[model samples]
Structures are given as structure tokens and as C-alpha cells.
Target chain A: MIIAVASGKGGTGKTTVATSLALVLGNRAQILDCDVEEPNCHILLKPTILTTDTVNLPVPSVDLEKCSLCGKCGEVCQFSAIVLIGKTILTFPELCHGCGSCSILCPEKAIREIPRNIGVIETGFVKDLDFVQGRIRIGEAMSPPLIREVKTKINRDKIAILDSPPGASCPVITTVKNTDFVIMVTEPTPFGLNDLEIAVEAIKGLRIPMGIVINRSDIGDSSARDFCNNNGLPLLMEIPHHRKVAEGYAQGAPLIESMPGYGHKFKKLSDDIQMIISESYEGASI
Target chain B: MKIAVTSTGKTIESAMDPRFGRAPYILIVDDNCNLIEAIDNSANVNAFRGAGIQAAKAIADRKVDMLLTGRCGPNAFTTLEAAGVKVGIEQSGTVREAVERVKKNEVSIADKPNAEAHW
Candidate 1:
């Protein structure tokens, strides 16, 4: 089953939960860090990258030689990436979404797609667990494309865990889409609860079965719990705020390895997820 | 020469808008500083992306010789420049005042984009 770990707010322990769960699942699980902008799971997992592939986006390249400034390519481009100004045709590679509309619709066929490197995808393994991640190039505004590239590395035979980026935006949507379930990590604060509500709305729209895992569950207000209770949403697990856990995380140590008995807790969490998935499958079959 | 000035309203007396891409109005004027017409630019205000390019196309379609605005992004600048439209940056005051400034050659045409892409 493909499970996505996500949070609407940043620094809410998405990496912590995803790494710990992968550790507990061991060889049975493959973890993909789809947070292309700033992937932190590598810091925790430290997988020795076996293979690296550069991700490229097909951007438009105009052949001025074969040119007719018929303005057809410009007219067909919704992105305004290409425009015919008098006899000159201007193409903005950054603005192009690589839709190939301009090339396809060009009367003169002066446009050709050129691969532009946007990011890199690395596949490796941590101990026995398969690991993959996508790191977007700096100053790249688009992360969804790279995230999609990372998802393609998912192994269907293993339990795939996707560590999604923060916010309920396009990147987050791309990471969470087509997952069997979602574990939303949130802190027990007003800010966390508000963002979690937005995330919950987004997930509900996708009709994905999701549960909340409240990180630092003891310090903040119980509003998150209350919100979950009111909404009848499942509260999967809670990781308390502890000095040792924090220090271990800072030292790039997995929670299951650093904290005593936490391996059992993560195992329980994994089993609970499996139970839910099986129950849902049974319900669907019935 | 016809010029387009980014404006906050649909009249020559309206205050000049600082933003070129998301400006509410584009007031077209003739060489004598007479108001030609105001084109609404509100459609680009909420554009998902590429507002500058769309706004530049809108102004270029009006067949204006010059653009007067507070700032122009790189994409819009290139589009306008390629269209042979001279851009006057840091334009302020009312639309009429901006037009008068342009006529008096008080606002010099920008050599490059004055602002980075905000989006």
C-alpha cells in the first residue's frame, strides 16, 4: 500500500514519522522523499545513493531559421511563454510549462522541445529499506514536476511511504495523490490546527482515508484533538515532546533507534495502518 | 505617438498604478496628452501566473508606442521591448501628469527591467 505522510505546516515532524515508520517496516517498505524543495529525510535516513538521474523538463526552443512569424505558436500558447512581436518571435523558457502546444499548433513548426534540467532524483537504500528522493535545483519555482518524478520511483511490491512537502498547495497535492492512505502530522497548536483543517479539506476532496499523528502532543492546546474528535477523524498516534527525541533528531538519528521502546510504538502504528487498509478493502468488497 | 499608462481607475485623472502586470487600468493617450480610452486590466490581477506577459500583450495589442508604469518585470519588459515599445519606469502621480511627464521627456525610457518578477 502506498501511504503518504504530509503536514500543512512546515517542521511538524513529517520526516520524523516517515523515517521512523520506514525503519519499523524494514525491508518491507520503501520511503520516497517527495519534498523536492528541501528534502530532510535524507538527513535522517542517510541512504547511500546507488543511482542518480537528472530530471529535465521539455521547454520550447525556437528555430529562427525555419521561422515564419505567423503568430500561430504565440496565439496557441496559453502561458504567454512565446509571443510574436512584429517579425520577431520571443520565447521565455522560464514561463513555459512545456505543454508543447506551441510546437504542435505552430503553422511554421519553428518550435522544438529542448530538455532543461530542473532537478535530480536519487535512488538508494537505507539498510534493507529502499529509499528515493528528488531535490529541485535552487531558484526553481516548480516542485510538482520533480515530485511527480520521485513518485515514479515507487516500488509497487513494497509498502511505499511518501514524505510530502508542507502546505496544501500543488506540490503537496502531487505528492499525496493516488496514495492508499495519508498520515497528516501536526503539532497541537492553533496554527497547526488551522493548517491541518485546510489540509483535511484538501484530503477530503481527494477522498483519501487519512488519520492525524499529533507531534509534540503534550505542549500545545488540545484543540487538534478536539477538532479531530468533532470531525470524527481518527487520531492514529501521538509523539510526545521529549528532550532525548529532539537531540536524537538533531543528531540525525532515527527515532526507532534513539528512543527506547519507540520501535514497538512505530510497529504498532504500522500494524494499525494495515488494519485500516484491510478493513477499508473488506468494506469496499462488501 | 499613442502611450499606455498603468492607472488605478478608468480616467486620465486617476492615480497612476505602480504595478505594471496587475494594474487595474491601462489609460491610452494620444501624442497631444489627450485621453484616448481606458482599457480595464483587472483580468490579469488574479492571473494564476504570467500576469506580466498577459498584461504586456494586452497593452501591446492597443498598438501603443510607449508604456509608463512604476515597475516592469523581466518577462513583460522583454515582450514590450521586442514589440518596439519604449518603457518609462518609476512613473507616478495622476495619469495626466504621467502623460505630461512623458511628453516633456521627464521620464526616460528604461534600459532594462526595473523590478524582478514578484510571482
Candidate 2:
């Protein structure tokens, strides 16, 4: 199943949940870190990357010599990334969303599309589980393309554990859309509860079934759980605040592997999720 | 045109509307730097992750010619430059002061992305 593990707020243990699930699921699973801007799952997994692919966005290139500055391209571009002066068709590749609307609407055909590298997607294997991550170029801001690139590395046979970036905005939406299941990790804090509402709305918009996992459950009350219960969303797991876990995290280690006693618990949670999603797809194992 | 300005919170309050969502509020301003809207979008502009597109449509709608703010990321800087909008920097005061400088054509843009990293 394609499971997107997400949290609207940063440092809320989304990566911890995603990587641990992948590690426990073994060869049956793969993990894609779609947090291209500042990906961190690879740091903990320490996978030996086997392949690397560059992610590029299509941007308009203006031919000043042959162009009549009619501003048609600019008019077509809702992004305002292209502006035509009296004789010059100015194109801003960075702001271009690669929608191809400008090129399609260009009457003079003076604008050609070119690839601008925005990021790189790398694939590796951690033991039996395959791993993929998108590394955004230092100056690039468009992460949706890179996230899509990272997702292309998924092997359908393996459990696809997607580690989404922290937000409820477009990037997070792009990562979470069409996933078989969604697992939202959150700390038991007011801020976590606040962002969780926005994330819930996004998932609802996608019409996808979702569950919750509470990290640092001991720090705050059960508001996250309360919201989930009130909303009829399942509360899959609640990991209490633990100093050892923090120490393990600081060392870039997976909790399931580091804390031996927790493996069965995570496995059970995985099995439950698989059972829920498996019914939806024929012959898919839970 | 409506413009989203990203700046230090200390000065943003004086010049922008008060609305908190994620973190760095997306201050929607008109051509005159008058507060028109505010959105919470710390993730979009926090480290300049997705500022260009997030603010592009709003600015385009306002017919703004310039984005007067503190620091801009490289992607946003180049994007705005290509769209023929002048980007100004280093002016610390109320939003009115920045708008005044923009009107006078005295504000200068950085050649590169000017955002400071939170890390």
C-alpha cells in the first residue's frame, strides 16, 4: 500500500514514524522522502543509494530575434512569470510552474520550452527496503516536481512509505494525494493540534481515509486524540515522551530497531493499516 | 496588485496586518503598502521554500510593480525580476517608509536572494 506519513508541523516525528515502518516492513516496503527542500529521513536510514536522477522543470525560453512582443505569452501565463515588453519577451524560469499554458497560447511560436534542473532524486536500499529521496537544488523553490520525481522510484511490490514535508499547503497536498492510506504523526501539543486541523481538511478534500499517531504523547493532554475521536478518525498509536527515544533520535537511529520491545507494536499497527487498505484493492496483502 | 511581504516579525506588525497562521504571516498589501490581507504561511516563505509561486498570483492581481520587503530568496528574486517588478531591500521601518522609497525609486534590489537562514 502507498502510505503517506505526514505532519503539518516540523519536528513532530513524521520521519521517525515513516522510517521505522519501512525498517520493520523489510523487503515488502519502500520509503520515499518527499521533503525535497530539507529531507532528513535518509540521515536516519543511512541507505546506500544505487541511482540518482535529476528533477527538471519546463520553462519558457524566448527568442528575442524572431519574436513580436505581443504579450500573448504573458497574458496566458497566470503565474506572471513571463512579461513581454515592446520588443522583448522576458521569461522568468524560476516562477514558471511548468504549466505549458504560455507555449500553447503563443501565437508567434517564439517561445520554446527548456528544462531547468531544480532538484535531484536519489534511490538506495537499506537492507531489503528500497529508499528514495528528493534533494532540492540550493536555490530552487519548486518542490512539487522533485516530489513527483522521487515518487516515480516506487516499486509497486514493496510497501511505499512516503515521508511528506511539514505543511498543509501545496507541497504537502502534492505528497499526500492519491495515497492508499495516510498516517499523520503529531506531538501532543497545542501547536500540533492547531496544524492538525488544517491537515485533516486537506485529507478530507482528497477523500482519503486517515489515522493518527501521537508522538511525545506525555508532554500534553489528549487533545489530538480528542479531536481524532470527535472526528471519528482512528488513533493508531501514542508514543509517550521518552528521553531514550530523544537520545536515539539525536544519534539518527530508528526507534523500532533501537528499542527492541517496540517492534511488535509497530508491526501490529502496520498490519492493522494494511488490513484497512487491503479491502479496497483486490488481492492486496494486508 | 496584492503583494506578500516576508520580513522580521518585529517590524512587520507596524507595517502589516496582524494575522497568524503557521508562522511568518503572508502580508497582502496593495500598491500603496496599505494592509489588505494577511495569511499564515511560515512554511511557504520560512526558508524561501515556495515564496515565488505563493505570492505570484496575488501580486499579479494587484498590478504591483515592485515588492518592498526585507530579504528575498534567489528563486523569488529572479522570478520577480523577470516579471519586471523591482525588488527592494535593507529598509527597516514601517510599511509606509518602504512604499515611500519605492515611490521615489530610491530603494535598491539585491543581485542575489537575500533571505537569512533560520538554521
Candidate 3:
């Protein structure tokens, strides 16, 4: 089963929950960190990477010789990545989505796709647990493609956990899509509650089974809990605000490793998720 | 020479919009500073993405010789420059005043984009 850990607001402990769950699962789980922009799971897991592969997007390269600058490529390109200016045809690889529309629709067959490196995917292991992550190059605007690349490494034999990026935008959607369940990590602040509402809507739209894990559960107003209760969403687990957890996190230690007995809590969290999924399946059949 | 000025409304009295891509209107004028027309740019303004490029294409399709706006992003600037359109940056005041300034050569032509992409 693939479970995605996501949070609408940043710093809501997505990596914390995801990494801890992986630790509890041990050899039975493989974690794919799909937060390509600012992947932080590596900070805690610190898996010794066994292999690394560069990820590239195919962008169009024009052949000036066979080309008639009919401007059709430019006209078809929605990104304005390719444009015709007088007799000059310019292609901006950064803006290209690698859709191959320009090359496919070119009348003269003058456009050829060339690979442009956007990021890298690294595969490693933390003891018996398999780990994989994608690191997007700095200044790169898009992360969905890289996130998709990381998902390709999913191991079906083991429980797969995906650490998703913040916000309910395209990157977050890409990471959470096709997962068995989504665990939304959130704090108790108003901003957290507002963004969580947006995220809940997005997940509901995808028709996925989801539960909330309120991080720092005791600090803020009871509105987050109230919102979940009114919506009939399950409150999976709560990690209280504690200085030891904070210091351990700052020192790049997994909560399960630093907090001693916290591994049992994460194991319980995974068991609850499994129970919810099986119950939903039974409900759907009935 | 026909010039386009990003505007907030469909009249010469409209304030010059600082934004090029999301501008509501494009006030067109001739060399004599006469009001030609104000083209509604609401379509590009409401676009999900690529507003800057779409707006640039819209203005370029009008065959305008120059563009007057507060800022031009890199993508829009490249498209405008490629189409041989001169850009006047940091433009403010009413549409008519901007046109008068352009005619008097009081606006500085942008050699490179003043803002990053998606600005």
C-alpha cells in the first residue's frame, strides 16, 4: 500500500511523520521522498545512496536547415517556450513542458527533442528500509515531473510512504495522486487550519481516504480538532509539542530513534491507517 | 509610429498600469498622440498561466512599434524584443501623459528585462 504524507502549510511535520513511520515499518517499508524542491527526509534518514541517475526533460531543438519558419510551432506552444521572431526561431528549454507538441506538429519535421537535465534521483537504503528521493536542480521552476520520476521507484512488495511537498498546488497533487491513503499533517494555528481545509478539499476531490495528524496538537486553538470532528474525519495521531522532539529533529534524528518509545506510536498510526483502508473497502462493496 | 500603453481603463484618463502581462487594457495611439483605441486585455489577465507571453503576443499582433509599461518580465521582454518592439519601462501617470512622454522621448527604452519571469 502506498501512503502519502502531506501538509498544506510548510513546517507541519510531514517529513517527521513519514520518516518515523518508515522507521517503525523497518524492512517492510520503502520510502520515496517526492518533495523534490526541498527534500528534507534525507536529513533524518541519511541513507547511504547506492545509485544516482540524472532526470531529464526532452525539449525541442530546431533544425534551421530543414525548417521553414512558418511559426506554427510558436503558435501551438502555450508556454511561449518557442517563438518565431521574423526569420529567427527561438526555443526556451526552461519553459518547455516536454509535451512534444512542437516537434509533432512541425510541418517540416524540423524539430527534434533533446534531453535537458532538470534533477537527479538517488536510491539508497537505511538498514533494511529502502529509500529513494528526487533532488530538483536549483532555480528549476517545475517539480511535478521530478516527483513523478521518484514515484517510478515505488516498491510494491513493501509499504511505500511518500513525503509530499507543501501547499495544495500542482506539486502536491502530483505526489499524492495514486496513493492508497493520504496522511495530512497539520498544526493548530489558524493558517494551518485554513490551508488544511484547502488540502482536504483537494484530497476529497481525488476521492482518496484521508486522515489528519495534528502536529503540536496542544499549542493552538481547538478549531482544527473541531473542524475534523464536524467533517467526520478520523484524527489519526497527535504529536505533542515537546522540546526534546524539537532538539532531536534539529539534530537530524528521527523521532522514533530519539524519543525511545515513540516507535510504538508510529506503528499504531500505520495500523490505524490499514484498518481505515480495509473498512472503506468493505463499505464500498456493500 | 503606433505605440501601446498598458492601462487600467479604456480611456486616455486611465492610469498607466505598472504590470504588463496582467494589465486590463492596452491604450493604442499614433505618432500625433491621438487616441486610436483601447484594446481589452481581460482574457490574458485572467489566464491561469502564460499571461505575460499571451499579453505580449496580443500587443505584438497589433503591430505596435513600442510598448509602455511599468515592468516587463524576461519571457515577455524576449518575445517583445524578438518581434522588434521597443519597450519603455517604469511608465506611470495617465495613458495620455504616457503617450506624450513617449512622443517626447522622455521614457527610457529597456535593453534587458527589469524583472524575472512570472513577475
Candidate 4:
């Protein structure tokens, strides 16, 4: 089963929960970090990367030699990445979505696609657990492409636990899409609750079964729990505020290593998620 | 020489638009400041990205010798330069006033983009 660990607000312990889940599952799981912008799974897991694949988006390259400034290339481009201005054909590579429309529609066939490096996908092994992460090239605005590349590394035979980027944007959606269940990590504070609500709304639109895991559950008000109760979302786990957990995280230690007792808790969380998925499928069939 | 002034309205009497790419209208005028055409730029104005580049292309297609606007971004500036169109940026007032300023060589043509890209 493919499960995505996501949160709308940053610093809500998504990486913490994700890493722990992967650790608990061990050889039975492959953790894919889809947070291309800032992947922290590697920091926790410290996987020795076996292979690094550079991901590229096919941007348009114009051959002015074969040249006719037919304006069709400009007309077909929605992002205005390629435009025919007077006798000059200008291409802004940064604005290109790598849609290849400009090249395909060019009657003169003056446009061809060239590889533009957007990011890299690194695959490695963390002990018995398989590890994969995508890191976007610095200053690269587009990350959905790279996130999609990371998801391609998902092993169907193993339980894929994806550590999604923070937010309800395209990157998070791309990571969460096609998952069997989503475990949304959140805090009990107002900021966490607000963003979690937004994220839950996005997940609801996708019609995916999701549950909440409230980190630092002891400090903040009970609003997060109240929200889950009102929305019929299962409160999967509540990790109380703990100094040791924080220090261990800062030292790049996985949650399971910091607090060995939580290993069983994470395992239970996975089992609960599995049961929910099965029940949903049974309900759908009936 | 045909000149285009970014404006908020169709006529030369209208206020000059400070924005280049997202300007609502572009009023084309002759050397003597006679209104030739008013090109609606709503498409570029509402564009999600690369608004300046598309707007520059539209103006270049009109075969304008000069463009008088509030500011020019890098992509738009580069496009206009490639089209051999002189850009006179940071001109504000009525469209007619901007045209008159350029006619008298009051506003200097920019060598590089005066502003960052809108995108």
C-alpha cells in the first residue's frame, strides 16, 4: 500500500512521522521523499545513495537556420515562453513548462526540445529499508515534475511511505495522488489546525481516506482533536511534547531510535491505516 | 515614425498606464501624435506568466518605432531590442503627453530593462 505523510504547514513533524513509519516497516517498506524543495528524509535516514539520476524537462530550442518565423510556435505556446516578435523569435526557457507544444505545432519544424535540468532523483538503501528522494535544482520554481519522478521509484511490492512537501499546492498533491491512505501530521495550535483544514479539504477533493497524527499534542489547545471529531477524521496518534524527541530529531536521529517504545506505536498506526483501507474497499464493493 | 504608448484607455487623452505588460490598452500614434489604433491588451494583462514578453511581441507586431511606457522588464526589453524597437520607459501622464515628450526627445530611450520581470 502506498501511503503519503503530508502536512500543510511546515515544521509539523511530517518527516518525523514518515521516517518512523519507514523504520517500523523495515524491509517491507520503501520510503520515497517527495519534498524535492527541501528533502529531510536523507538527513534522518542517511542512506548511501546508490544511483543519482538527473531529471530534465524538455524545453524548446529553436533552430533559426531551418528558419521560418511562422508565428505558429508563438501561437501554440500558452506560457508565452516562445514568441515571434516581428522578425525575431524569442524564447524564455525559464517560463517554459516543457509542454513541447511549440515544437509539435511548428509548421517549419524549426523548434526542437532540449533537456533542461530541473532536479535529481537519488535512490539508495537505508539498512534493510529502500530509500529514494528528489532534490530540485536551486532556483528551480517547478517541482511537480521532480516529485513525479520520485514517485516513479515507488516499489509496488513494498509499502511505499512518501514524505510529501508541506503545503496544499501541486507538489503535495502530486505526492499524495494515487496513495492508498494519507497520514496528515499536524500540531494542536491554531496555525497548524488552519493549514491542516486546508490540506484536509484538498485531500477530500481527491476522495482519499486520510487520518490525523497530532504531534506535540500536550501543549496546544484541543482544537485539532475537536476538528478531527467534527470532520469524522480518525485521530490516529497523539505524540505528547517531549524534549528527548526534539533533541534526537536535531541530532538527525529517527524517532524509532530516539524512543524505541514509539516503534510499536508507528507499527500500529500502519496497521490501523491498512485496516481503514481494507474497510473502505469492502464498503465500496458492497 | 509610429509610436505606441501604454495607456489605461483607448484614446490618447487617457491616462498613461504605469505598467507595461499588464497595461489595459496600447494606443498607437504617428510622429505628429495622431491616434492610429488602440490595441486591447486584456489578454496580456490577464496572463499568468510572461506577460511582458507577450506584450512586447504584440507591440513589435504593430511595427512601432518607439514604445513609451512606465517601465520595461528584462524579457520585454530584450524582445523589443531584438525587434529593433526603441523603448522610452518611466513616462507617466496622459498618453498624448508621453507621446509629446518622446517627440521632443524629452524621455531618453532605455539601454537596458528598467525593472525586474513581472513573473
Please tell me which predicted candidate would have the highest lDDT against the true structure. Answer: 4
The DockQ-based order of candidates, best leading, equals: 4, 1, 3, 2
lDDT tens readout by residue for model 3, A65-165: 99988989988998778877666787888888999999999999999999999999999999999999999999988788999999999999999999999
TM-score of every candidate relative to the true structure: 0.95, 0.72, 0.91, 0.98
Indicate the worst ten consecutive residues by lDDT in candidate 2 chain A: A83-92
| Candidate 1 residue lDDT tens string, B1-109 | 9999999998888999999999989889997778898888888888866788888877777788999999999999988987888999998999889989976889989
Model 1 segments beyond 4 Å from truth? none
CA lDDT of each candidate?
0.90, 0.76, 0.91, 0.92
For all predictions in the order shown, the interface RMSD in Å is: 1.4, 6.2, 2.1, 0.9
lDDT tens string, model 4, A1-286?
8999999899999999999999999999999999999999999999989999999999998899886878898888899889887766888998889988988888888888999999999999999999999999998899998999898889999999999999898888999999999999999999999999999999898888999999999987999999999999999999998999999999999988999999889989999999999999998899
Best by DockQ: 4
Q: What DockQ does every candidate get? A: 0.63, 0.07, 0.44, 0.84
Q: Lowest summed-lDDT stretch of 10 residues in model 4 chain A?
A: A80-89
Tens-place lDDT digits, model 2, residues A158-270: 78999999989989988988788999998878999999888888888987778999999989777998999899988999898888898899999899866777888889989
lDDT of 2 by residue, B41-61 (tens): 555444332345445434544
| Docking class for candidate 3 | acceptable
Candidate 4, TM-score of its B chain: 0.97
Model 1 Cα lDDT, one tens digit per residue, A1-286: 9999999899999999999999889999999999999999999989999999999888888898898778888778877778877777888877778788998887778888999889999999999999999999998887888998899998999999999999998999999999989999999998999999999998898878889999999998999999889998889999999999999999999888789689898888999988988888888899
For B1-119, candidate 4 gives per-residue lDDT tens digits of 99999999999899999899999999999988899999999988888988898888888888899999989999999999999999998899999898888757799889999998767
Candidate 3: misplaced stretches above 4 Å?
B9-15, B34-38, B59-63, B94-96
RMSD of each: 1.6, 8.8, 2.4, 1.2
